[model samples]
Target: MLARTTDPIVAIATASGRGAVGIVRVSGARLAPLISVICGRSLKPREASYLPFRDAGGEAIDHGLAIHFPAPHSYTGEDVLELQAHGGPVVLQLLLARCLEAAVESDASTGQPRLPGLRVAQPGEFSQRAFLNGKIDLAQAEAIADLIDASTEAAARSAGRSLSGAFSQEIHTLRDALIHLRMLVEATLDFPEEEIDFLQKADAEGQLATLQAQLGAVQQRARQGALLREGIKVVIAGQPNAGKSSLLNALAGAELAIVSPIPGTTRDVVSQTIQIQGVPLHVVDTAGLRESTDLVEQIGVARAWGQIEGADAVLFLHDLTRSAGTDYAQADADILRLLSEKLPAGVPVLDLWSKQDAAPSTGPVTGMSLSAKTGFGIEALRQRLLEVAGWQAVPEGVYLARARHVQALSRVGEHLILAAEHLAARAQSLDLLAEELRLAQNALNEITGEFGADDLLGVIFSRFCIGK
Candidate 1:
């Protein structure tokens, strides 16, 4: 985690495995000598040249394409070298070692190391350097990782937009507006006895109203973006023979969970990830919730409740066919009571009546009735889940956002609201109004790394894969 931007660093740039080609990337202040020693020739800036990568013994380690990027024009705003060789672990490792060896070896005449202080790059060190070098902001740096790890095509495209400065631009616009408003407020403070009605003349109140509306719009988009990034976790819970497994299979479009008429057939949790309109849904099918004598089933029931507690949503499946029976009614009432007392707050529970095809027309029915065997009411159920999740239809210019961004925007909104309250006091509270505006701007600045702590930077970049 101790990353020095000045140190020359190298890492395998591509994924680990046998492929058609693998890449070894090096970034530093000066890489010309390292390139010459390893590639046997100085590379032209930004041009790919076919060369033989050599070792300290002057033996060819691999023949590959060498490309050089000079300082201030590279991804990290430093001199960079890339060696694309055969995609074998051994070959890549040899090339990586030679780069390190060349950096430490002394030059014959100068008696100085060819490339001093070369080291293996830490996870996300490359992107962190890019941020430090003014190549990209914090939000854009995070987007780079998000783009690589995106699960769906929509998520990838949204991350691309964020990386391209779409999200940053929106933040910049809001910050600029706040700055203008702060300037107006501060100007009035300089002259108290002028009686010029500065606040009225400058339309400060109108501007504040507009800024609040714009912030709301941005927050709406950010929430949708966050949903696309993190998705949702859903746990399916019900008594044995309630068609919980069948519902799981229906939603996944495959037999992911075992389904049988025997009670307690599922004695463990089964999970599957399925997407609904590009949003990933991690679905977990747990053991049937009921009184059991077996030890394993008891353990599974406990685990099922554990999963429910941590879930973003819960699907409480009820056997519609058995709704008329007194014993079934009593069991259902017990499960409801348990859910009322034990389920986590804010997690939406969908009451689904399964086996709609065989259910007798009882007097009054609650919740959606669906037959997993026939795929009936499945689409409605999917839509309901999305609604509970606060997901909206994908809109144009949608960009990827994280929970941190949403929280920052929320803070900004709070500060702006407080600023408005101070502004209502006019000249008496001008100083407090100015302070609120400044606070709002600072929160917005954190989103783009205009103001960020060292510890925050470390935590962010540490999650990135090496060579990113």
Candidate 2:
């Protein structure tokens, strides 16, 4: 998307609906004349005034609270005007149209239009402007979107922390440390004739060690934050009457999926999102995995495998009540064999023995047994899923992060590792070490948008809702 920074932009800031109030926001270099044309009076900077939003015909379009924020103090670092009117779609649209119309109208004495080429703001354009104007970094800008789309309270809290500059501050601290190290390395290169070793005198190795440790800490937190932001997808697969539906309902704490004694009850993927200890788990209850002659049942079994292939984790549920039957045991063995051979590599599989209430002590079972009816072993199952997901308890100062942030941190670690390897070679590898350090710094810089491409910015902001 083309970013027109100079042109004034307007948008309905609040969600579209009939509510108690709605807001039409406008931002530009100088909005006093436009404000006067729209509000029919000069608005004091950073003050709210109850006034009639008028049209060019001198008729009141709507009565609303008008607030003016002068340039360098507003959200986009430009003069801003907000019209808080009655929350009606028609009213907000009318107010927005008036704002645009007033932008092109000339002042009685100045003859020039107050805002030339005023237009509607694009999706995420407001936040993009805030980033470009140095009001917030790229990380904080992303946090704004994350905060809006957060699925769990923990995710929202983490996003809030990132927006408050906690995540960016940590990145800046790491960058500052890297810059200091670079200065010492560059100084040593500049003074080649000096007998004294500058790096050794400054204990550069010690500093690098500390920096690596700090990066590790940041990476750990970023991983957890990413988990909170993008929760794990789990697919449940098992033979008929294995309590897969019951397990899903138990996890969700609601009867989201139908449960009965009949086979093939779930003919499609039944999905639900439930939070466990602030981590969202997207559970998909698939049709029973079995060899069926029925056409629809076969299709469902195929679909079940399809879901399993894309899942982050799979629950290979087994029926403990059917353990004594010879055919049931053989069928369970066959399913286990298929799972071992057909399941995708790297996707963790949890062997769950369901219906513990009926067979309380099934002998020599490999996986955990639980009664979905009685909530027996459900807590252990929840804890195991979290472990399988590599999720730890949300630590203090934890902030929301995205997959890209984790990838960037991983790249930084890779570069640092190469730098340490080069530093080990001492005299011959100082130049290589410095280069590695520079690369590492660049990777970290991308996280905060200190070094990023225009296209990356476009893609990031394009995902945001209009009016940010």
Candidate 3:
């Protein structure tokens, strides 16, 4: 990508399939010559002209609409041409090939190639070019892909906000505030004799406090936005015939897992995604946990433990009907002990009493009771799941954000904390305070591509679909 940023490129811009229309797009430093060759005439800037897309022999390959965008006013900040042709696989392929052929055809006037170095575009190269040329920043470029791949309406809307620079604007505001404080600290550092007096008069402590408060607010929203993009993973584990599979089927509204009276029916994990208030929940139903002599059941139990350990949350289902027996109580206690031993700290484990419709009226009452067969307590269970996920459903609505954004903000907060501590130290650590503030600003710049590594940029753009 770094090697070919200057080269002219072309691609089939629309998704692969039959539709009413398909577009073949080209971007380069100069496309007027290539446009004249393929389009057969000089196109009016930014205007669509209906004409025959001709082959080298002057025969019509397809009739299409040709639109031209002059340099510096296009998606990639380059001269661009788009051919809107009939949506047919064969026809589009022919048009795509014709573009390559026409680009290399010698000009009649100069005996030179019509457009040198025209090649097929790499996945996301177009958007990468836009970023490189200042048409958009890194966050907005990522939002383009997020919007396209969004699984829910809320996710899509949030991606649109990020693409429109809402998230970037917030980052910029934080950066500006950080810069002001850094300026104050660095100015005071230049004169050690009056450093203490300088900061006090400039209200550096108050400024840093305000910055931290603003950062806390941004971090809260960014966390919520990230949850919308990357939802929580939930694992359901319990003894056999506890209705774990039934509960899964109920939650997903489909029979994704097998339901049988046999104790070891579920021998592997079954997964589904359900949305609560447009926040996705990736739920996994694991095989029943128990001591089993059978080799297959042992393996299933082991796999269930594996899933349980990695989950963001666990739903430990209990068989209420078996609550009266001492042996059953011992088994429940054993499972609970293992859960505590294997699961990470702070990972919530919600104990649920299954088969509520069949349980005897007398037993220890604990946890939420629900019968998957009758759909009892399912709504409350869903709301509980949302709470475990830490979703706030912000009133202003969330803008789509990635895990990296959350991590970056966390790092910024860390730096600010150190900056404040160093600031309070006064003349003893003015240099340290300035350094932390500069580091914080760099983290902020990373989200906008104002400061970043090349490999990071490559990894980012590579995730995009081709011809974006």
Least well predicted 10-residue stretch by lDDT in candidate 2: 359-368
**For candidate 3, lDDT tens digit of each residue in 249-278?**
999999899999989899998999999898
Show model 2 residue runs off by greater than 4 Å: 342-344
| lDDT scores in order | 0.90, 0.90, 0.90
| Regions of model 3 farther than 4 Å from truth | 1-3, 193-196, 360-364
Clashing pairs in 1: none
For model 3, what is the error of residue 369's alpha carbon versus the real structure, in angstroms, after optimal superposition?
1.2
**53-152 per-residue lDDT for model 1 (tens digits):** 9999888998989999999999998888989999999999888888888899987757889889999999999999999999999999999999999999
lDDT of 3 at 407: 92
RMSD of 2: 1.5
* Residue-by-residue lDDT tens digits, candidate 2, 1-468: 548778889999999889999999998887888888888999988889999999879899899899998888989998888999999999999998888888888888799998898999999999988999999999999999999999888999999999999999999999999999999889888887986788889998899999999999999999999999998999998888789999999999999999999999999989999888889999999999888899998999999988988899989888888878899889878877877787778888888888889987674348888889999999999999999888988666689999999999999999998888887787799999999999999999999999999999999999999887
Q: Model 2: how far is 274 from its true place, Å?
A: 0.3
TM-score of predicted structure 1: 0.97
